[model samples]
Target chain A: MLGGARSGKSRYAQARAEAIAGRHTLVATAEARDAEMRDRIARHRADRDQRWRTVEAPRDLAAAIDAANGADAVALVDCLTIWISNLMLAEADIDAATRDLCEAIQRFEGQLILVANEVGLGIVPDNALARRFRDEAGRANQAVAAAAQEVQMIFAGLPQRLK
Target chain B: MLGGARSGKSRYAQARAEAIAGRHTLVATAEARDAEMRDRIARHRADRDQRWRTVEAPRDLAAAIDAANGADAVALVDCLTIWISNLMLAEADIDAATRDLCEAIQRFEGQLILVANEVGLGIVPDNALARRFRDEAGRANQAVAAAAQEVQMIFAGLPQRLK
Candidate 1:
């Protein structure tokens, strides 16, 4: 699932994931570096039920997905952009990380719902870092969309299927 | 049509507009405020054939659309986000303007193609102005999509129909 902020992507992805009859694993990418972030993370968590086993994967997401792999597994990565941001902050090789992610996504037997923000539609950022981040985010989304069996873009709670 | 920066939205919209055998009107929202913008506008202009008549509508978009309305008119609004930005900079009432634009779109007889940036998908902006811009842009987009007969979100040059 791909969408802008407040586009209800996470809500849609969660609903989709919950509909599947399987073990629910939420591999979250958010890390509470600040109070606002902590509150936001808490609110998201509140929407999830007890059925979901949370796995904090601010980085090392591929490994987390690998760990959750099963015939009846339903893994919802509550986003890729935050994970990408984390990787960037850690100075990790983004290309290699994205590659690993695609590979993991391909090989995983679970029904995966990968949520990502479509951040490249705005005017070019004033700062170089912001621009670079958008570029990486857009590139990663394209790569993932190519790998996935289905893709949907959420706009104000509406699902528009792309694949 | 709505899409991100360099996501092939303009190219796709141009192709769609060119396909319509009508009096082509390119209602452009961009103004050359700086050298970079001037160059960008020039490059975009070079893509059009001699058939298209240009109308500059940095803020007066509704009037431009009204002027271009005809049974055989093909009007392509190159963008709406930049126009919104111009309105915001001018301290114009965004909601009222959006309402007027939507009304004009509904009343238009032309084969209309609208371009807008989906700017709210990324991490929230650090500044208040950007956040407001994204909010206004998103609201305007939803309004436009509702008014439009068809809506599309372009990604990597591929068009995905939304409505």
Candidate 2:
């Protein structure tokens, strides 16, 4: 699933995972490194109950997915852009990390849904890092959407399939 | 029409304006205050022929439209958010300006197509000015969309009618 902020992509992903018969796990890539982000994470946690087994994976996303998935498990990676940011902040290789993550996604046997933001729909960022991040995010979305059997974009809280 | 940066909203608007049988008037709200912006305006000028009579309305959009509209005219307002930004920079009353613009739109005699960016579908800006601008843009879009006879959203270079 792909959407802009507050477009209900996370909610839609959670709902889809819950509909499937399996152990539901939410692989959160957001790091509460700032006060505002911590509040956002807290709100997200308050929205879901113990029904979701949550894993914090600001990095090492593939490993988290590998560990969380099982025959009867359905894991949802809550977002990809944050993970990209984490990788950039950590000086990790973006292409290599994206490759590893995609491989893990392809290798995983359990049902999975990935959430990413559609960030390319706005103005060109005025700074270099923002522009690079936007480009990287667009590339990541294309790679994931191509590999996945299904792709959807959320607009105004409504879901529209793109693939 | 509403879309992201480089999403062809301007091109689409220009094309729509060209297709209509009337005196084509482009009410551009952009101010070429910078070199990059000047280049952009130049490129836009090159794209259209002498058929388009351009009006540069960085602010006072209502007056621009009221003056541009004619019995044999079709006016295309290239965007609203930039006008909003201009209004903000000039310390213009946003609500009053919006009200006046809507009134002018309602009273226009020519065929009209308005373009605006879908700026609300992104992460909340961390700064107060950006946040306020986003809110104002959203309000402006809603007001314009409500008054218009038709509305459409563009994604991935495709158009979807919303009303």
Candidate 3:
């Protein structure tokens, strides 16, 4: 599921994943780098309850997914946007990340639910750096959409199936 | 200027605009529809210190820019990714948004600073919608980078000039 901040996209995605899978594994991309983030993470964790086995993978998402793959497990990635931002800040190669992600998705043996933020409908940023980030995020979204079986956009606490 | 979450991207952009041109205008894409978001908007206003003019335009960014254009006023867009997400959720034409953003940049008459989140270089999303968003953000970044005079990536609260 994809949507703006606090759009209930994540909740919708989690509910969908829970309905489809017997065993749920949530791969979280967020890092508790600050108190506010830590609190937010805690709230999300509480919201998910104890049914999910959480894997915190701030980096090396492919490896985490590879390790978590199983016939009975449904893997749900809470977000990709934050992970992308982390890599960009780290000065990692975006193409490499794309390739790694695609490869991981191909190798996975079970159903997967990936969440991401849609980030390109706004005004053009003045600085080149922010602009580049937006462009890269857009590219990543397209590649995943091409591979995904279903595409949904969540807004105002509602889900609109796009693909 | 960069900061985590609410860290000073908008404030810095506004300050930069005020420094370059005494009178500054803000292009706000966030819709204040909920208490949380309303709080966010209020915080942004408080941070701006009353030196800047604000224009709340949730969509049709090009028209907003045109309406706010002036010879001596600097234009500052608080964000781009959120606007893009809004469009995606609304099923708005992504191509139109891209075209309009580029046109606005090409025709901008004064200094402008834009805020955006880098959303590529992360784990591949499992669903089609997320993948599409990542791809679109990437493409948008490339398009803007190709056209913009400068490009930068903000990481760890620091700016890295890419172009």
Candidate 4:
């Protein structure tokens, strides 16, 4: 799943995951840092209710996914963009992270829904840092989408099936 | 702005945009391809209220931005990732789209909050297409981040000021 802000990508991915398996595991890539964000997290948590087990992993997503894959749980990676940003600031190698994630996806046995942002359709950025981020994000989406059985683009809260 | 699924990135960005400017314009990058997605879009529309003008633009973001720019309206680009994907699939030269977006950004004089995904932190994709998308996304993020005056990362619905 991928799309613009508030494009319903997350909700769509979550529904798909829930439909696939009873034991749903949501591997979150976000870390709460403020009061506003806390509220948002709470809302999301509430929306999922008790049916989904949420794991907060700002880093080390591969390990987290592997741990969740032990059971017959359907793993849903809700957003890879944030994970990438976290890794960049943490000084982790982007290439290494991508490689690890792909490997984990290949090894996992249960159903998976990997959600991400498709961010490459805009203008070229002015500075080197911005350009670098854009390039990495583009690569990440491609990798995940390729691995995914179905690729979807959500716009205005609508999902367009891509692959 | 960027974050994981249900990470509050969109709300944070929306609030920021509302607080900073008067007349608001939302440049959407989703294509609305499913029933679930339609509901998602409706939710977002309700969230935004009737104060802002919405533009349905799945491609040619530079032109959309150009049309949205004016003295009374501030452009809020809710995302860049989907736009990139659309370009990658539709346009022959993705780099040209990047260049056009950047150029438009440079010329725009109003308040613009451009959201994008950071995609380089995950494991390297196994296939060539995935690898290429990751690389392109990274480049795009870096470019936009460098160009923008401020950059923020959202995690677990919490935002970290990174600029």
Candidate 5:
């Protein structure tokens, strides 16, 4: 699943996972780095039911997905863009991380849904860093969509199939 | 049609218009304010064959559309987001302009295709003006979409129908 901020991608992905009868794991990539992020993270958590088990993977998402993978498990990675930011801030290899993530998703035993932001539609950002981030995020989205069996873009709480 | 930057929306819109055997008008909302923008606009203009007639409508799009409308005319507004920015810079009434533009679209005697950007998917901007622009752009997209007979989103040269 992919969408803009407040486009209800998380809710849509959550509902998808909740529809399946089995274990649920939320591979959270958000770190409560600031008050805004903290509030956002808490709000998302509040939306999920008690059946969810969240594993924080601000980085090392492949390991997190591996740990969460189980027979009959439904795993929702409630975003990849944040994970990209985390990797950028940590000076990690993004392409390698994305490849590993794709491999992990392919290897997963259960259903996996990945949520990412589509951030390159606006006027180009002014700063070099923001421009770079936008490029990287877009690249990751395209790569992930290619790897996934189905890709949907959410806008105004509506899902449009992309793949 | 709506999409991110360089997402092939213009190409897709142009192709759609070209498919219809009729007169084509490109209702351009872009202004060559800088070298980059000038180059981009020139490139887009070069993509069209001699069959296309261009009208520069940085603002006052309804009038431009009305003027361009004719029998067997296929008019494409290759974008609303830039028009929104132009209106913002001019301190014009965005809501009112959007309403007028929609009415023009509804009344148009030609095949009309509108292009817009999905600008709200990224991390929130640090500046208030950008945030407002994002909000305004999103509002325009939803409103325009509601008025459109059909809607499609373009990504990486691919077209995905949304409605």
Candidate 6:
């Protein structure tokens, strides 16, 4: 699912993941690097409850998803943008990481729903890094969307299936 | 209609205005105070042909709308957030201005399409002024949406009617 910040993409994805009558795993990409982000992570954790087995993977998302694969299990990757950021911060090859992640999603023996933020809808960021991040996020979304069988966009707490 | 910045809200509004087989007047609220803004304004102006009689109204939107009112005219206010910002920077009474704007829309005889940016979707801003602006923008959107006969949200160039 694609959406802007606070557009209910995470909550809606959680609901969809919970509906599947099988093992559920949430691959969380956000790190509690700051107070505000910690608060957000805490709130999301509380919302998921014990039903979702959580995997903390700020990087190595493909490995995390590969490890969580199970028969009849459904894995929900909470977001991709943060993962991209983590890769960038660690000086990892973004193109390689994205490719591996897509491969993992395709090879996993269960359903997968990935969430990503649409950050390109605003004015171009003033700094070079932010602008590059925006461009990378857009490219990552296109790649994943092409690999997925269904794509959806969330707006104002409502879901619009695009494919 | 409302949307995120660069989400094509202005472009969509301009296309809609062009299609109206009547007098079309575009109320522009952005001032070209900087080089970047000047370029953006130039591009927008280039996209709009001579058919669109432009009214530059950084403030006093109600008066501009009242002036542009015509029997067979469709007046499109390119944006509302910029007007709100103008009001704030000038220390004008936001509530009073909003009321007057809504009253103008209610009293206008011609079709009106007002565009606004969704500014509350991101993380809580670090500063009080930005937070205040976000709150004010949200309140303005709600007030105008309540008065509008039809409300739409533009997402990735797709228009989704909300009301």
Best prediction by TM-score? 6
**Candidate 1: tens digits of C-alpha lDDT, residues A1-163:** 9989756789889999999999999999999998767987998999999999999999999999999999999999989999988999999999999999999999899799999999876667789899888988889999999999999988855688889
- Which candidate comes out best when scored by DockQ? 1
Using all chains and alpha carbons, the TM-scores for the candidates as numbered come to 0.61, 0.61, 0.51, 0.50, 0.60, 0.63
Q: Which residue runs of candidate 4 sit more than 4 Å off their true CA positions?
A: B1-163
Q: Put down candidate 1 lDDT per residue, B1-163, tens digits, no spaces.
A: 8888889999999999999899999999998999999998999999889999999999999999999999999999989999999999999999999999999998888799999987787656987688778778877887787788888889899988887
lDDT of 6 by residue, A1-163 (tens): 9887889999999898888888888999999999999999999898877878889999999999999887888899978989988988998998899899989988898888899988865543557688678767766776787678887898888999866
Which of candidates 1 and 4 reaches a greater lDDT? 1
Candidate 5, pairs of clashing residues:
A4-B121, A121-B4
lDDT scores for all predictions? 0.90, 0.84, 0.74, 0.75, 0.88, 0.85
lDDT, candidate 2, A1-163, per-residue tens: 9987655678778888888988888999999988867987998889886889899999899899899868888999988989888888898988888888888888888899999988876666777888888888889889888889899876544567889
Docking class of 1: incorrect
Off by over 4 Å in 1: A6-152, A156-158
Fraction of the true interface contacts (Cα pairs closer than 8 Å across chains) found in each model: 0.35, 0.09, 0.00, 0.00, 0.31, 0.09
lDDT of 2 by residue, B69-106 (tens): 78788999978989999999998999999999999989
Q: Name the TM-score of candidate 1.
A: 0.61
Between candidates 1 and 3, the one scoring higher on lDDT is 1
For each candidate, the DockQ is 0.22, 0.12, 0.03, 0.03, 0.21, 0.10
Tens digits of per-residue lDDT, candidate 3, A64-99, equal 888888888799997888888888888998778878
Location of the lowest summed lDDT over 10 successive residues in candidate 1 chain A:
A119-128
Model 3's TM-score against the true structure:
0.51
lDDT of 5 by residue, A1-39 (tens): 988888999999999899998889999999998999999
Alpha carbon deviation, residue A51, candidate 4 (Å): 0.9
- Ranked by lDDT from best down, the candidates are 1, 5, 6, 2, 4, 3
Q: Which residue segments of model 6 deviate by more than 4 Å?
A: A4-115, A120-151, A155-158
Docking class of 2: incorrect
What is the CA-based DockQ of model 3?
0.03
